[model samples]
Target: MSDWLHNLPVPMMALVIFGFTYFLAALVFVAVALAATEERAKSLKAISPGMLPVLGIIFGLFVAFTAAQVWGDSDRAGAAVSREASALRSAVLLAAGLPAEQETKLRGLVRDYVGQAVAEEWPMMAHQEASLKATPPALADALKLVVTMMPQGRAQETSQREIVAALEQALDARRQRIIVSLASVNSVKWWCLYLQALCELLVIGFVHCDNRLGSAIAMGLFATGVATSVLLIAAHDRPFTGQISISPEPLRQIMPEAPTGHS
Candidate 1:
């Protein structure tokens, strides 16, 4: 069920979340209607006049802040991906300065690394897992192979050094990408959101029982609005999954031979 939910497109997920939230709110309304006495409802309604606006404002701000944080994290994850791809391109260009024989070897190594990255590493990003084939030792082996040959000239030597540095930079960026991919909003925060939403809905259900149609309409809208925020956060939460995932296009273009991978 979770996988099915996660696989849904952003809009679909938003709709699903909205429907579920509204249904839950409806249940709350029914429960309150069953449980409330006239006297209790009147008292709660009296307090509701003073409380609803304040609670709405606080919860709205909290949800907005949480959404902002997730969006920021997703943005950083995308930037890290671009930076990693750029460094890879730099390493490729630097390889051009080597002798023909050495250049072939270095380029092949780079190609394999890139191939494995797109082929094996990229798919793992959706789940925030590192690809074993694209691990440091595997990439380092490819790099070590490039530096093993003596440089043909001063220019070649300089280029080799640059290639090494660029590869290192790429690795650093890759690490950052991995870290960002793995990061997510805390579960505790999500639980708190649910708790707050439930409380607010319960209050609304109790205070508005006299006008079922009006309360249902308002409850549906409010629940959908809050769920939309949550859905937006969920969509961006991974930055490497769902409809808004970071594309592997940059890596594909940079990779020589351009191996088709599971995107």
Candidate 2:
């Protein structure tokens, strides 16, 4: 769940998860096989195969529950970014209603804000370091200008009010994305998930203790399933931190010709 692991490309991430699961399966098999004496085999055989289905069900439930949260976070992150871009686009269009000088300044402000978001805020979001403790300065200045600017007619007056509304929408969208960026699977849930998996692996070993070949094959298949489930969840767990994260292209499109370097 570390950033290093999440940032790996999909194929490499799959390899790591599969390899770890296989190794753990092998370890459990070796331990159980070593202790499988003739009398122990009899007792081990008594461990009902019915428990296999029961344990498997419990493990599946854990994976399903965890996956739901991860998928939700990803969806929310994408929506927030899209909504922010749309609001900024509205502001840029509405600026045309103002005097030529004021319109130019408002457009420049939007450009500055998008550039900062791409070059500065993005990396911070990826690392879960973007905080809402301070307002974005470019957006703040735009809001102040819209509120205080003198309008000569109904057209400019309506534009000013709508621009303020658009800026507020963009601000709310920014807050949503930052909050979603901070989301991740907590340690307690991870601990529970792994512990459940280990229990299932142990049960498999007990059920097939007398036959090493059978034990290995069954565990290997189950391990593959476990690995696949884990990989799917982990790849999308931290929406902004991973290779498959939501992009800033929507924001960049608002001011396509502007440079994206931090000032």
Candidate 3:
């Protein structure tokens, strides 16, 4: 229920969040107004000094902090995807420097790896699941296969070394990306965000106990703003699941197609 709210399109998210929060705020206001009437016989104060402004400041800072953290996580996830693709491209270039037999074999492995990652593994990540179990990169086997072909001379040996290094880097990048796909913000932080939002509304409830309709309007506006920010943060909570997600464009660009015979 909450996730659906978070990932909704911006206008829908704002409307839904405002609707729910406004209802709750109105309910709180009614209760507070009754209490204020009862207490007025003894004391005529609506609320304590400076509570609303203080709570507003606190809410704003919390939103800013959470947004920054989630933004950083999303950026890191995207960079991991790019790095993995770059390493794979490097491996392909170095593989070309090998003998014809080794070159074909290595290129085939690279091609299969790219194709699988783009078509199969990427969809799983979008769903916040681990990558597909079938057709695992078999990266180790590929490395060992290349190592089996002893280089003909110093130049070949150097090229093989660079290819091995690049593949290893690609493997590391893929590992990072998989870990990132499974990542999420902590539950405690979410609790704090919601708690503060409620607190801000509660402050409004108490301060506006004398005017229900005016309070409701104020809360509607406030709720619209807060809920939009909260949903924006929530939309970014899962780096791979929302509007601002990492794409597999890099991998797709390198996917091997059939050989052409134009000549």
**Candidate number of the best TM-score:** 2
* Cα lDDT tens digits for candidate 3, 141-223: 66887777799899889989998898888888888888788777778877887789888887776666666787787777777
Stretches of candidate 2 off by over 4 Å are 256-263
The worst-scoring run of ten residues by lDDT in candidate 2 lies at 254-263
Residue-by-residue lDDT tens digits, candidate 2, 1-263: 78888889999999999999899888899888887888798888899999999999999999999999999999999999999999999999999899988887888889999999999999999989999999999999999989999999999999999999999999999999999999998878878887888889999999999878898999999999999999999899988887889989999888734434877
Answer with 1 or 2, whichever has the higher lDDT: 2
Q: Rank the candidates by lDDT, best first.
A: 2, 1, 3
C-alpha lDDT of all candidate models, in order? 0.76, 0.91, 0.76
* lDDT value, candidate 1, whole model: 0.76
In candidate 2, how many clashes are counted? 0
RMSD per candidate (Å) reads 4.1, 3.0, 2.9
Single out the weakest 10-residue window by summed lDDT for candidate 1.
130-139
Residue 105 Cα positional deviation in candidate 3, in Å, after optimal superposition: 2.0
**How should the candidates be ordered by TM-score, best one leading?**
2, 1, 3
Per-candidate TM equals 0.89, 0.96, 0.86
